[model samples]
Target: MKKDIQIPEVSNVYVSVVNEYNDIYKTHDWNAYIINDKDVALEMVLIVTRGFSEIKSTSTMRHKLDMLPAKSYAKIEFMQEDVLALNNEFKVTFFEANKMFEKTYLFRKNTINKKALQTIPLMEVRGVLVK
Candidate 1:
């Protein structure tokens, strides 16, 4: 008779946003809890929002953290702005340790009372088994 093996659940995941120019604005570790899982696969998403302005030039560009993975493939998209804009949006997708994950956002489309930028800093990571 063969025995059935159970895979442990993946949890305790988070995300953060880093500004390469300003270290002070960088977050070491932000809270982005996992809310969904399926068939030994875990999925998560996060967002970071902010605002900025520039003088001297009418055209402005914002850099966003798109896709970043330690050992997997990823895809990222910015739906709302072109190369020139004071504000922007971001969307990211990636696979970690063989599992899939994704994130998305839209920025600079609402009143000043709302957030201007969004980011996803972390993805749940796992180890692959070798035969």
Candidate 2:
């Protein structure tokens, strides 16, 4: 009976981290974004994120969106410099084609740095992407 469960595989969706300039704060900040590259829209999008290490962890954060259109992206949250040393994880769940799908993206500890950045999909800026 348990084998009957089927969770659709999530594709063309990604979570990325970007170091961007904050005009109000006059500082460079690390921000998280969710990118949907598919031709179809995603509904009931939800994201839960957290940072953790072997002995330390940050609070869990939950974010929601009514819909995420195709070929678009949305900012999830900002990360302080201190959390860069911990493993950051983003769990994304959404409904597409009348089915529910989920995927988890991770930025390993110390990996979200300028050296690891590349042109993020569907966005003009360069950033570290989890695919």
Best by TM-score: 2
Clashing residue pairs for model 2? none
* Full-model lDDT, candidate 1: 0.30
Per-residue CA lDDT of model 2 for 1-131, tens digit only, reads 88998998888999999999999999999999999999999999999999999999999999999999999999999999999999999999999988999999999999999999899988999999999
- Give a tens-digit lDDT track for model 1, residues 1-131: 23554333333222222212225656322221222222233323333333334532222323333333332323222222222233333333334455554454333322211132343333333211010
In candidate 1, what residue range of length 10 has the lowest lDDT sum? 122-131
What would the TM-score be for candidate 1 when compared with the true structure?
0.24
Q: Judged by lDDT against the true structure, how good is candidate 2?
A: 0.96
Which residue ranges in model 1 land beyond 4 Å of their true spot? 1-87, 110-131
Candidate 2 weakest lDDT stretch, 10 residues? 1-10
- Superposing every Cα of model 1 onto the true structure, what RMSD results? 14.2
